[model samples]
Target: MASTSSGGTVELSGFFADLVRCETRLYNALNDRLRERHGIVTSQFEALRYLRDHPGSRVADLAAEFAIGIGATSKTIDRLEKQGWAARQPNPADRRSSLLALTDNGTQLVGAAEKTFTAEVAELIGGTLDSSSATAAAQALSKLRSVLERNQIGTPTG
Candidate 1:
């Protein structure tokens, strides 16, 4: 009883909904695996890895990069510091802000997390779709993500 235009809209909406559900499931599994193996959640592991990759990054920088509130960023840094994974150092360029640096333990944890995360993601992809389908899905999803970010959809602007 629906017009063709309406039918197409419904189909596209269903596709978007399915994509969100798939992403949620994948991320939940990833977080659970990382937490069980390393005692750190996905976000914390990402923060540690980010510090390792970009040493001397400020808390504000991390907050912006993660699209999280500054207070939440501070709490994440606090947890890393408590675990002896990261530490704050004096920022010569900005007296108002401190720089983040990874400790040896943090570096080690990042390395391990990278391996585990990579494997998990790969397994999810390989398990979910065949080679060609995975490639197609990756390309489609990546394009969608890029467009969303560019449009600032569901993202905070700095």
Candidate 2:
């Protein structure tokens, strides 16, 4: 097999490579912890977290926020509901759509999950990123996302 630099890794642009590696590392790390503690996937936690915060957010809106397909988002919500962590009500604004909110049980469970998730992240990053650094990173990533969306480079896939 022919090889050209970068240890024969498949050719990927710098930005794409960084995104792939970062996502892989972060997802793997979080998945292990979330599974071990709550038996939930990161996506499930994200769905419940959003519902907990948004109170009466519509399923479509949550799907948009997560940048995931409607069916996939619905599946996550279904799992959450089955777990008694989330509840859905008529949107009222749109009969075709349903609003999502965390059940009391969900709110408490997710709260605990979040605390554990945060502690794990803190330990992983150690003091490498303080509050300021974390804030800056968030801002930069947000800006990058805006640019990508604006130019149609990449739309979030939840």
Candidate 3:
């Protein structure tokens, strides 16, 4: 492999590319399973889980946490509302924006989804690596994620 000017590691750029591909595949597989079991995509499942844990958060807050646009987050909240899983209540702190909340049904769905999601992820990853390797992978990925989050990393712009 040809080396880059930044470093002798020719695979540095490819490392990020491969990571993106891996993430895409993982999310696709997880989303498919989630949709099949609960009629909810991974994004919706994430939003629901967040709201379940952090009640009174707005769509904007969720969008920021999920690294998505406010408009998209609002749409997600709309779908959750339609499914009777989430509801928007008038915010006491801010009369302009309503806070999102998980209904009883939504809470139950998230609880069920969490069990299946965690199991599926473990099985999917562990099917490839042994217990120790899986743990190592988790630790490494968490570190990488922390750095990226701290740096506010996103899509490349030139």
- When summed lDDT is taken over every stretch of 10 residues in candidate 1, the lowest stretch is 1-10
Model 1 lDDT per residue over 1-158, tens place: 22254326345676778988997998888899999898888899889988988988999889877777788899999999999999999999989899999999999998998899999998987877899898877897889878876876765543
Q: Write down the lDDT that model 3 would get.
A: 0.86
After superposition on all CA atoms, how large is the RMSD of candidate 2? 5.7
Angstrom error of the Cα, residue 45, model 2: value is: 1.0
Superposed model 2: Cα runs more than 4 Å off: 1-12, 126-136, 150-153, 156-158
Alpha-carbon RMSD to native, per candidate: 3.6, 5.7, 3.7
How far off is residue 120 in model 2, in Å?
1.7
lDDT accuracy of residue 147 in candidate 3:
86
TM-score-wise, the better of 1 and 2 is 1
lDDT of 2 by residue, 9-66 (tens): 5444775677678778877888899999988878888888888778898777777777
Q: How many clashing residue pairs appear in each of the predictions shown? A: 0, 3, 0
What are the per-residue Cα lDDT tens digits for candidate 3 across 1-158?
Answer: 44565536557678779878988998999899998998888998999999988888998788768777778788899999999999999998989899999999999999999987998898788788898888877897999878887897862221
Evaluated at residue 104, the lDDT of candidate 1 is 92
Q: Is candidate 1 or candidate 2 better by lDDT?
A: 1
- List lDDT for all candidates, in order: 0.87, 0.80, 0.86
